[model samples]
Target: MTQRIRELLDGAVADLEPGVSDPVAAVVRRGRAARRRSVLAAALVVALLGGGLAAGRQLVTTAREPAPAGPAELGRPPVPRVVGRTVVAGAMRLPIPDGWTAVENDPSRPCGDLHRTILLVVTGNRGCQNASVEVYGSERTYPGGTLVGDDLLDEDHRIVTPPVAMTLRGGEPAWMSESLEAADLAPDRYPEFAFWNVVTLPWSMVMLQLRDDGPAERKILDSIVTTPTEAGVLALPDSARSVSLTTPDAKGRNLPAGAARTKDQRTVAAVIALLRAQSDVVDDSAACADPGRPRAAVSLESATPTMVVITLGGGCQEAVSSAGGRVRLSDATLAQLKTLLGIGAR
Candidate 1:
């Protein structure tokens, strides 16, 4: 197609009018898929014509804390700007770089949103790869529900590649999962999700993932672990105290498999609380429940269900007697735990 024709088609494709119930209706349920593809193809021609930045170059920032003004620039490429710096506690801060956005809807938890694509960039060592971290949400709503549409680029992550059906966004590879369960009990309707990562340059990159529910996003988002640095994370309220939990295993009369399942349940609960807490606010985390194994953990938002960092400890699984598995909380941590449990913070 001629460049002019392509541009025109591109505009039409981008305009796939989906209403509220199906905002993504344009690409998901409607017959506009082919047109959408053509538009994305045309737009890619324009992006290449302007500058050939690859898919992994797009970065995202999702810090609620205001970015430093006139702070020392790391002298990285100009494409990715300083989004925000989160101070989890003294001597530990993570940088939320540019091109990403934050999400804050849950009343209980409040971590900002960083586009998943941005995480892939840093994870794979594309840009500033020194153990970079990013957070994602299954409940998040981007321009297109699926990562395949050109509208996908409109998100904080900004899809930069040519439109391809079920293509990888950024540098991350693509994988899809169906019927994943969410960590939170909240009701969600999304059922299909896709994921992949892209390494941009030695200093930066882009990572992408889309899910029908928040569970997969939570699990994966909860898995990101970052190195402690002097940058500092977001501060919790004075009322906020570092809290921790180690839920006890309830498997009693079951066989070894049942006991193992019970142990997993306890671990999952502990991890969920940790993840939910991590998505909110509480500082300084370590696995106290099962020190022998890596407990699932993540950094929480200051006020909402925003996930800062996530990881599965105990190497993702471990075995233990019922009595041995108990979720423990520090006295100070217990104060914060009450709020999560709706028991009022001590």
Candidate 2:
């Protein structure tokens, strides 16, 4: 796993440790996405504090602006400084700070709902869209206590000032909390700010979430702002990167005869699509030579297995007869199957 992904998974594990009622309870009560959203909103509190950006706006446009020509690549003041290759999201280019760890996701792995998240531990108290800023592109809101895809703040268990604690990262004070529950909450109060930031890209969605607020957030933000874009060096380490399938090729690839379509195929197809969507990563060149051959191949890369090459060759009917007279794709495999079902020409 990439450093970023390891930390994220570790955070989730930490939240689940015994006696850690706050984070665990919050997660169980609210949910992973909700908790992540809430934490992100908290970190963003500072960034959104002064800026008079529109709130509750539903932005769904595609951002395709090319990287700036010179060193002043990161956005203007108050935004995270980034050096190296700027990540392109929906309508914006994200800056990657220096000295922070990053994790690249595997292209072969199935893409989750969150798509991808970039984690950084920076110094300073100032906040800059702490959540998934790289995925949703802009802040947004869903209906009925639902956290928007790009919402920096999480409202799964809505509260203005959720319970909080302090931690350390990059030699800075970081803050942690489960739900934002302040005593003086209004009936319909949404957090003033949190950590979720969504940036949309031409190929896939990117989400950035700040688990804590302390030296880490500041350090990360600072690096992003200072990193020079001229050299094409992304100062911030991309601990995790992911590529997905651009399309499916059912006509050329082979599948088991009598293979019944299942929901798994759809899920896997989505992940494949996401991986192939990356601008830097190229799609698999090999195509399914024969759709009726009961065989197919998929190419992918990520943190785990740098490249996952799956070759499917067996009629569903034949496999079923061999394995307890039944043939079914594992839940995980189903995800990939879904992608194949949807595959089109590259």
272-341 per-residue lDDT for model 2 (tens digits): 3333322221111211211122222222222221112222334221111000011222323434443343
lDDT (tens digit, per residue) of candidate 1 on 45-119: 335323322222223333433323211122222122233543121111223335433332222333333333233
* CA error at residue 47 for candidate 2, angstroms: 27
Model 2 spans > 4 angstroms off: 1-107, 110-136, 139-207, 222-346
What's the lDDT for all of these models?
0.25, 0.26
- Candidate 1 lDDT (Cα, whole model)? 0.25
Where is the poorest 10-residue window by lDDT in model 1? 22-31
Candidate 1 has a TM-score of: 0.21
